[model samples]
Target chain A: MKIFYELGRYWIFLAGMFTRPENFSIYRKQVMLEMDAIGINSVGIVSLVSIFMGAVITLQTAYNLINPLVPLWAVGLVVRDSIIIEFSPTIIMLVLAGKVGSSIASEIGTMRVTEQIDALEIMGINSTSYLVIPKMLAAIFITPFIVLISMFVGIAGGWVVGELTGVVPSLDYITGLQSEFLPFNVFFAMVKTVVFAFIITTVSSYHGYYTSGGALEVGKSSTRAVVFSSILILIFDYILTQLILI
Target chain B: MIQVQNISKGFYGKLVLKNVTNTFEEGKVNLIIGGSGSGKTVLMKCMVGLYEVDEGAIEYDGRDFSAMTKLERKSIRREIGMLFQGSALFDSMTVEENVMFPLTMLSKMDEEEKRDRANFCLQRVNLDNANNLFPAEISGGMKKRVAIARAIAMKPKYLFCDEPNSGLDPKTSIVIDELIKEITYEFQMTTVINTHDMNSVLMMGDNIIFIYKGEKFWSGSSKDILNSGNEQLENFVFASKVMQDLRRHLKN
Candidate 1:
């Protein structure tokens, strides 16, 4: 019953955020700012994690395939598909759920505790739309691009590791990357990235918007934002895969 | 003028404002005074439409505010400005941007006009040479003054302030109180302030309401306060030794 109550409130919060903005130009400017904060600021961590994860995936895949009959190009196939299908979209989002999710929550939670949200409301502004919509739109607009970067960087990392460790020849690895490549796989990854982006921004925003206490409560809301967003991302990852892949 | 009529508000089945009724007049400093958790804040919030009353209605210059829709309220809200306890300036914005925020969001004024209005407001608050500085870079008194400038930036008809002197030195508190009083008369705004500051009440409270444990206990001008014969009001108003001595000195 409590969960149902929270779910209902969450839907209402989302509904409130979709109302017509008081000023379109101000909102447009805010959207640009949010894009910088949510997307541009995140490139470094996303790239670093993607590169390392890709290298590890390649090495592990090479060691697993020991059969004499199996072609070495299969290692490249595994690296490319694994990175594109799961690691880049799902795992990278989980990492961002910690970095970006907590940030959105804490910033908003601080605003809530300090009466800044009240100040907005009293000024006849739609606080929910003004604060959250830009963040949601920015995440939806930019996460796919982030995932695309992760896919390219991850593949490149795998190629570098393969060449340096002698796991597979460059020619065979390239062949494997091109083997049985499905365009639908990229589309599927993009679809999941968009959905996960919504979840992370909205869920974290909900936690922060309803925050009622001081600094201690703000910290707790940040933790909840990350935890809940990560959990939802994993859940949706499974759901999207089942619906799209199966 | 703002009229709160028989409004009651509750939280989790416990009433925070019990049948609170009052009229805050225009062109005067109307102060709401009470001890901590006495529901003064709740009463002010309810008047401003931040909290819905469980019973009764709030009217702004005879318009039923409590019955209005959210869309219908925006026009009234645009005519209202508020100063919060924490000043509540946007942390990311500079002082000039903070004061210009309302005009930027709601008015058709061009950038030059907006900057002019912001600078005029900042100057009115006696805050000069600090346009580019962020809220974090200012002192407590300067922050409150900046908040006042922002509050008046829209040239609002009604002003609500919640504990404007909560964390200030006595000198700064007196300065804020005088600023609020001057603005109220100059703008002809129906200003409502919530505070327990005795100096503010005695100095600028043209109209005052005393709330005790979620009930309106007394209402009068500051001059009538020492002889109001309300025990709870006396206890709260004279809680400090300085106030009590001042009361004694006044009686003599």
Candidate 2:
């Protein structure tokens, strides 16, 4: 019953955010601020994680394909497919679920407890639209770009590591990366990234917006937002993979 | 003028404000005074449409505010300004930006005009030098004053302040009370303040409503409050020993 109640309330929240913004100029500025926070600020950490993941995947795949019968370029093919289909979209987003998700929840929860949300409402602003919609828009507009950067960096890291570690030669790895690459896999990954982005922003925002009490409750809401967003990302990753690949 | 007609509100099956009916007059500082958890804040929230009343209508001028659509309510809300207990200034914004927020969001004023209006409001609140400071950087009294400046920046018809002096020194509280009264008169605005500060009530309450346990216990002017002789009202108004001593002195 509580789950149903939350679900209904979540849908209503989404509905509330869909209204026309009272001022497009203010919303546009808000979107830019959020985009900077959600996208640009995240690049360093995402890149750091993605590069390491790429190197590990390359080394692991090369070690496993010890059979001389498997072409050396298979290392590249494996790394490319793994990063595109799973690592870039799923792992990076899961990392963001912890990073960006917690920030959104804590920021909004503070506002809720301090009556800032109430202040906005009294100013004739649709508080939900003013606060959450810009965040959602920022994530939707920017997360895919982040994923694309992660994919490129991950593949480049794999290439660099393979050549340096003698896991696979650069030419063979590059050949394998180019061989049998399915464009649809990239499309599938992008679809997952967008969906996960929506989940991260909205789920965190929801937890924060309704938060009551003081600092302790804001901490709890932040933890809940990260946990819920991570769980949803994993759930949707499986669902999207089955729907798209199967 | 704002009229609340028998409004009632509850939260989670607990009735917090019950059949509270009153009028907050224009061009005066109308005050709602009560003890902690007396539901004065809830009543103010209902008047501002932050909390929907469980029963009865709130009228702003002649329009039935409670019955209006969300779109219609926006029109009413635009004419309303509020100072929250915690000040509620945007943490990310500077004082200048906070005061200018309504003008930036609700009006098509140019950058220069918005800045000018923000400067004027800040100056009015005696916060001219703190424009670039964020809410966190300022002291509590400055934050309250900044919130008041923001509240009045839109030139609202109604000003609602919830506990504007909660954490202030007596001197700052009096300053805030006098500032609110001056703004109310200067703009001919209906100002409704919810406070437990008896000093504020004595200073700026042109009209006063006392709530006890979610009910409207009494209503009268500031002058009448001294001699009203209502037990509950006296207990609340003269709760402090200083006030009680003053009352006895005055009676003698």
Candidate 3:
């Protein structure tokens, strides 16, 4: 019951934020900037992780397909299937929980701890929209872009492993990947990305936005943001997968 | 004008402020003086809607703040400005950005207008040349100046200061007090300051409300404070040796 009340209050706060034109105006510019900070700027870490993920998927698939003359093309098919269906988008956000989610938390949490949030209240500004909405929009709009990049890089990483280990010929590997690919799988991944983005960004911002006390409390808020958002991301990943594919 | 009427707040079933009611009028520094844990700060916060009141209501020009919707309350909040004890400037932002923040967030003014207004406010607070400096690089006094500049950037109708004289030297305290008073007069703002400093009470206390154990024990100006004939008021007014000497000089 208390949780529902909290959610209801959050909705009211958000509603109040959007109802004002001046406050919503701040979001337009701030969101674009935050998208670059939390989303585009995460390219290096996402790419590096995607490379490893692809290599690992190829290795696991090769071991499974190695039984008594199973075709190498089948191994390529499995790698593409797993990468498209699950690995790239979901794991990337889990990694983002550490990088982007924590950054939002600490930044906002410190603002709260230091009374900057109160300062905003006195200035007649919507601190939630000024601080949270920009980051929220950034997370929702930019995650799809990041996930798209991750998928491409991860698939490329698999290709590297398949060729180097001679698990599959390059031409046949590429063909198998293309043949097994379903357009709807990519669409589903994008949908999941949006949902996950909303959950992670909103939860992380919420933790930071309401932070109280001193410096220690800000640190705790950041940690809570990453841990809670990451766990929820995994849980929702399964639920979405079941809903989409089953 | 802000009229706090019989406002009380409790936390975890423990009463913190018991029926605090006072009027902080426009263009005057209204000081809420009390010892630590006496609920001065909490009472001021209750007036601003930062904390909810358990009983009674706060009125801004007779509009009951507690009965208003969150959006309506927020609209009132936008017309209010605050300077926190810690200065509370954003560490990541430059002084210019910190001052410009409220205008950027709240005003429909163009960037140039915002920049011009921010610069003008910084200049008003004698921080014109320090616009590029970060809060960490500035002195405590300068940080307070930055906070004042930020607070006034929006030209709020009400200004609240919590511990405005804290952590500063006697000289800087007076300087900040004078600045607050000057701005209060210039803007015709309803200024409410919470302080424990007897010096501040005498110096900036155009209107003083003394809270003793969460109730208004004394309501008078800085002048009447020394002669209120209330023993507790006398003890508090003469707590400082300097004040005692001054009181003695006044008597002589």
Each prediction's number of clashing residue pairs: 0, 0, 1
Candidate 1 Cα deviation (angstroms), residue A4: 0.8
1 or 3, greater by TM-score: 1
Interface RMSD score of candidate 3: 1.8
Q: Candidates ranked by TM-score, best first?
A: 1, 2, 3
Q: What is the DockQ of each candidate?
A: 0.90, 0.91, 0.58
Write candidate 1's Cα lDDT for A54-136 as tens digits. 99999999999989899999999999999999999999999889999999999999999999999999999999998998899
Model 1, B136-163: lDDT tens digits are 9999999999999999999999999999
lDDT of 2 at A38: 97
Ranking by lDDT: 1, 2, 3
Task: List the global CA lDDT of all models.
Answer: 0.94, 0.93, 0.85
**Model 2, DockQ value?**
0.91
- For candidate 2, give the lDDT of residue A232: 94
Clashing pairs in 3: A124-B78
Among the numbered candidates, top lDDT falls to: 1
**What RMSD does model 1 have?**
0.9
Model 1: how far residue B85 lies from native, Å: 0.1
Best by DockQ: 2
